[model samples]
Target chain A: MPSLFFYLFTAITLGFGLLVVTARNPVTSALCLAMSFVGLAALFISLDAYFIGTIQILVYAGAVMVLFLFIIMLLDIKAEEGKKPNLPAVIGGVVLAVILALQIVTVSSSYSLGKTPLKNAPLSLNKAAETSVLPTISNDLKVGTLPDAKLMGLTLFKQYGFHLQAIGLLLLVGTVGVVVLSKREKGGQDA
Target chain B: MITLNHYLIVSALLFSLGMAGVIARRNILIIYMCLEMMLSAANLTLVAFSRFRVVEGLPDYAAQSLVFFTITVAAAEVAVGLAIIVALYRSKQSVEVESVTKLQG
Candidate 1:
């Protein structure tokens, strides 16, 4: 049953992923990318990564993509003349696709993927346990807690707090830089 | 039905689509969306591998955390990148890559 949801979510995500690039309108492509993010988040939820999935929907699909759309709508420009795409581009794209397909097949056949330690891994979470997911199916598994979002929270805020803060500060700086770069006076340009 | 290979196949398709967008498209905004697609493909690969192979049927907390970080960075990147593009659009009134002057290569 859960796997059913997974397949559906994966299909939706991949479909929107294609549409994001193929769509001609910039606004439409941005919206499709947002849909793709939501679909991916749903896939994460079906996989039992509840917290991460929630944040994915909230942050990426919610805040970030909205920002992109706001800009797209605000700066409504007529579509520019598309480049005269040629045969070489098509051939290169096909070559890359074949290489990636081969990689996926090689990866699937070699690794002992599905059968190893996932036969009966439990899905329930214990409240006091802090970690959400159940124990590893590996017989020799030794990790005490099944380290999940809560544990990740602990690590991010405690052990890696500085790095996290640094990232935040970096984002703030980027935001300011973008605003400054984009809002410069037109008089300064040579054209 | 939902094997690790299934996720990989999806990721591969997403990556290929993104590559096509990058190679063929002239619109800068669409190219940026394609870049996001590629990044999402990488994230899917990381989470799938951590879940199936590394953590071995356990909930891969580290993968989730890494995915979160990647999303955060991607969010930041799009913010600044799109702002620049918007500014360019305001100045030149277009979003075509070849016309952007910075992407002639």
Candidate 2:
């Protein structure tokens, strides 16, 4: 069952990703990107990271893509039909893709295959207390159910509070900057 | 058995495709979409690692938190980036990469 889902999500994500790059119409590309994001979210859910999967759909597929579509609509740009594919760029991209594939294979060759600890890992928090041979400090911190989301919140708020504050500030600045930058100059003058 | 390597392979392929789109496309919007694709690919790799690789007794969500923060920042980035693209379009009436030559003076 797990393997089937893994293959399905992988196929959809990669297929839509390919379409996003190859599609001529910008709108088509944007929609394909959304489909790719949905596939990615499913992959996350299959991995048992429920919070991240939900946020993946909410943020990337919902909010971000909508922003892209709105801009594309506002601009009303035509399909880019006149531009010819640059031979050198296409060649370089293929070369880079080959290099990346080789690098990942080489790096991951050391890890034991199919050795994920979650294979028989307990799902409930209470079960963790009964099967302990490791340090109890970290294990004790684990929340019983939905550990991924709970631990994420704990770590983000406790260990990385300052970083979260910085991100909030960054978002505020970005929102203001976008508003200011997109606004037209008074009297319809050139910016 | 879907191992960690399988997720990494998919992510690597997606990243490469996004890279190709960024390098080959002339339209600014398509490039932006590709950039988002690349970000999503990275996020997938992170989530996969978090799932399979246990950190001793830790509940294996540190990497997931990182992905969360990354998504937040990506949202902010797209907003600002699209605004800049819109501003450029207003003045130049073109979205092609080669046409933005106001600084070439």
Candidate 3:
């Protein structure tokens, strides 16, 4: 049953992903990409990464897609209705992608660790509670729940706090860079 | 009954599709969207590995943290990329990849 849902979500994701690639209109492509992100978020949830899944929806499907649509409308991009695709690039891309996919499938199928089922490596709440330092996290674990978001927050702040700060700096720089890049020159000259 | 391989296979396929899109599509925005798809595929792989690899009897939060960072960076990247694309459009007045041939030898 779970596998059924997994396959269903994967189909949804890949199908919409294909549409995003093939659709001529930018708005249609953006909407299909949003649907693809939603499907990918479902796959994340199936893996028990509930927090990641939620943010995948919030960030990718919600914020990122909206940004894309806004940009598409702002640019007033018309559909490539009559343009001929570069045929050599299309053929090469399809062939290369197929080869890469097959290689990945082959490697993953043969990987010993990947064959392990989720049930075989179940999360032991008692053991987690034993190892946990925080009362809230340990309490949740003790009560038979996986405090995913709390644990994620703890992990981010505890272990990767510096990295988190670095990411924040990166985002700030990105914002400034966008402002600079999009700002028009005052003297009617391209900078 | 799904194993880690199932997730990996899905991720691989998604990444391949994105690769094809990036290479074949002429529209810079669609190519950018494909890049986002590729990033999401990597996130799926990371989350799957995080779930299967238990640390302290719970799913490894470290990998999940990396996924979080990846998502953040990707968002930032999209903003910067789109801004550049918009700038490109202002200068060239076209989003087609075949435009902007000043660098071509």
Candidate 4:
């Protein structure tokens, strides 16, 4: 990825991220967050994690943001207009954020490995194909293509299959929990 | 040239922004959005490392798989969290953080 595009996406991600923080209205914050996620997905693609990037958009920008919007509209939350801001918390939050950012910058700058550019660590498709067990993966790599999704699928099923099933179970539990939590009580009694 | 540090810096800044939002925003829903942003920042870091660290002559797929699980879990979390928020709203009739002071003692 070119440095220009990297910076462009970085700006998009962080800029909208800042908006998400500062926007008074919840809906605006949610929309800005969606834009930030889209930019983040672009950054993932730049890293050559194509499948991750695609799902970042699909799950976050598509499904997740829609859920946020639905809840925001359903709750009928008005803009926090005329409310006095919590001065101490605001100051503390900004200071804490700055401190954390500076700490990461200092540490990463001194870290030797982070200095390497993408070009220096180019994917070795032919070499990977030579050792790959899956014929489809090997074939795609042999053809000078990066089969990102296929590789990810293989990794998940071959190596982390159990974890995948656990995630499925977690999702099922979450669904049941949501239904139970939101269900109206008999006789309209508050919990 | 975009080094791994560039991505790292971006991710760090993004994370900081999310942290600030979580602390400063009074709206519970926006706070949840900020939490998602922080999660995405972590995802960015993992993907960046996966790209920069080559394994077996290919980018490591392990980190990407972890990111996939993270996304799935985050989605489920959002569903449950929003449901909880709806219940809170139904009971308290407000989404402001100040409204949920029952446990503030």
Candidate 5:
């Protein structure tokens, strides 16, 4: 069952990702990107990171995509019908993509590449077996605190609370900047 | 069962597709959407790694939280980026990157 879901979401994500790039209409590309985001959110959920998955749907698929669509409408982008495909650019992209795929596959196949250093390190530092931010469990305990949405909230509030505030500030600044840059100057020009 | 490699392969494919989109698309909006796709692919890999790698027998929630922060940043980026695109369109009347060469002047 799990494998079935993993494959399904993987196909959805990759397929829509391709469509987003290839669709001639900007609006269609945006919509396909939204679908890709949905598939990505499902993939996150399958990994048991429920909070991130929900935020993926809410922030990415919902808010960010809506913003993209609004801009597309505002700009009134016509169908990109007459543009000639640059053969050199397409060929370069394909070659680079193939090289990247090969590199990632090669690097990922060696599972212990980054693990050896930790494997020899002290258990206290590397594993933190005795203590952590999450609720502690005995080594032989049948149940453990698997990182889920609840644990994620605790981690965010405890460890990253200040970072959250900083992000809020960044958002505020971005909002103001957008408003100022986009607003037409009085009696001058649309820009 | 799905392994970490499965997720990594998925992410790699998405990232490369996004790269292709960025290169092939003439429209700035489509290119920007492709950038968002690339970010999503990276986030997927992060969450997947956090899932399989156990520290002290507990899942690494920190990576998941990092993904959360990344999403927040992406939202802000899209808003500001689109606004800039709109502003450019108002003055230039087109969103093609190749045609907008005023920056070079």
Candidate 6:
């Protein structure tokens, strides 16, 4: 059932994602991208991470996409101008081909090599046992003060708070900068 | 031999496609959206790794936490990127990168 959700959302996301890339008009492409974001959020939901999915919709699809469309409107870009068929495309194409070939080679080699399973291992052995150990670290961080979510929250606020604040400040500055940059002189500063 | 490696290859494909979109497309808005898609592909890989590697019940949520930060940064990028695009449009009639080379020289 969850796998169904996985396949469904993945298809939807990747489909719209393709549309976003292949669409000619920027406006239509942005709209397609909004749809893709919604599908991605749904994919996150299937992983049982509801918070991330909801925030993905609210922040990315809702606010961020609106801003993109707003800019699209402000720019009033009808058709793309002087869109020279990227002659430099060969450089990028070669790079992509190399990267993808490397990936394919790596995966193919790894697959053929195969993972060695434990000899005569008990079927009762847990696969995920090693991963859950990190939570133990949080509890030992000064006793009962560290729940998983609380530890994560505290870490964000205490350690990474400045970076968060910096983003906000940067947004404010960018807003001011855009306004100032767009405002033109009245007199003949014109060419 | 459909395994975790298969999933990783798909993720890689999605990522490369996104990167190519950013590089090949002339539109700035599309470039930004492609960037988002690239990030999504990376997040998918992280989740896949966590699902495969983590043993149940230990409360390990590092991948989830990292994803949250990735989303936040994406939001900030959109805000700034849109503002710059708007400003650029107002100064110059077209949004194509080629046109902006000379400041009306």
Query: Over the stretch A1-191, how does candidate 4's per-residue lDDT look in tens digits?
Result: 38899999999999999999998888898899999999999999999999999999999999999999999999898898998888888999999999999999999999999999899998899999999998999999999999999999899999999999999999999999999999999999675
* DockQ per candidate: 0.50, 0.62, 0.79, 0.82, 0.55, 0.37
lDDT of 1 by residue, B1-105 (tens): 466666677777778778887877777777787888788777777776666643333455667667878888888898889888877776777777656676656
Models 1 onward score TM values of 0.81, 0.88, 0.98, 0.98, 0.87, 0.71
Expressed as tens digits, the lDDT of each residue in A104-191 for candidate 6 is 6487457742232212111112333333245554344335222445435644676678766776687677677657655665783532
Error of 4 at A111 (Å): 0.1
Winner by DockQ: 4
**lDDT tens readout by residue for model 5, A1-191:** 77888899999999999998888888888888889999999999887678888899999889988888888887778887877877788788878887898888778877753332222322232244346444432332334334366667777889999999999999999999998987789997564
lDDT of 5 at A136: 35
Docking class of 1: medium
Ranking by TM-score: 4, 3, 2, 5, 1, 6
Task: After superposing candidate 3 on the true structure, give the runs of residues whose Cα lies further than 4 Å from its correct spot.
Answer: A189-191
Look at candidate 2 and tell me the lDDT of residue A77.
Answer: 81
Candidate 6: what lDDT?
A: 0.65
- In candidate 4, stretches whose alpha carbon ends up further than 4 angstroms from where it belongs are none
Fnat for the candidates in order: 0.44, 0.66, 0.85, 0.88, 0.69, 0.29
Which ten residues in a row are the worst by lDDT in model 4 chain A?
Answer: A182-191
- Chain B alone, candidate 3, TM-score of 0.98
- lDDT per prediction? 0.71, 0.83, 0.94, 0.94, 0.81, 0.65
Clashing pairs in 5: none
Per-prediction tally of clashes: 0, 1, 0, 0, 0, 1
List runs of model 1 lying over 4 Å from the truth: A79-87, A114-149, B53-58, B102-105
Cα lDDT tens digits, model 6, B33-52, are 88888887787666555434
The superposed Cα distance between candidate 2 and the true structure at residue A55, in angstroms, equals: 0.6
